[model samples]
Target: MTGERSVPKPLVLQDEDARGSRLKNTDLSDSFLRNLKMRDVEIRDVDLSSSEVEGANMSDVRFHNVRMENARFDNVNLTNVSITNANLAGMTIDGVLVTDLLARIDPDDDI
Candidate 1:
């Protein structure tokens, strides 16, 4: 068997410590993560589409150049969060359109 490649097995880490590790070009799709202490972690160029996150404490997090189209967030705190230069088209807050709210705030300004 020449030029044959072997399939890699799934890597499992239970009760293991992997702090201060850098992961690049890793495929973690369909992976299950529970009870993880990922505070002060910096993640960049990651694909987390169609992922379900529950019971997460993500306060004081910074997001830049992130694409979150058609993403739904429920019961998430946005205190003191600032968003600028974002595409808010077709976005809503509490079943009310954001563009409508902005229109109410400043009727003369075009949205």
Candidate 2:
């Protein structure tokens, strides 16, 4: 088999406080972001394919024009988040029960 692997892109964090910061227009392809606490963070026009986000707590997060293909979100707590025009294909949220956290996203999604 050919060695064709997709590497995850790096996450550009705003600052130490991560207040009013946003990770927009980033290219995080196939990267795994785990155990990170994100608050009031906005992700727009980013590609997060095959990324594993586990044990992370997020609040007031906004996703606009983001690409989330084959992303894994397990054991993650997303309370009061928002996502718009995001491509969420093959995303799995097993073993995690979400509430208002994912309400910002869509409920009638096929992913």
Q: How many backbone clashes does candidate 1 have?
A: 0
Query: Residue 81, candidate 2: how far off, in angstroms?
Result: 9.8
Task: Report the lDDT tens digits of candidate 2 across residue range 18-62.
Answer: 556445555555555554555544444444454445445444444
Q: Per-residue error at 92 for model 1, in Å? A: 0.5
> Model 2: runs farther than 4 Å from truth?
1-35, 59-111
Using TM-score, give the best candidate's number: 1
- Per-model TM-score, in order, reads 0.87, 0.34
In angstroms, what RMSD does candidate 1 have relative to the true structure?
3.1
Error at 19, model 2, angstroms: 5.8
- Name the top lDDT candidate: 1
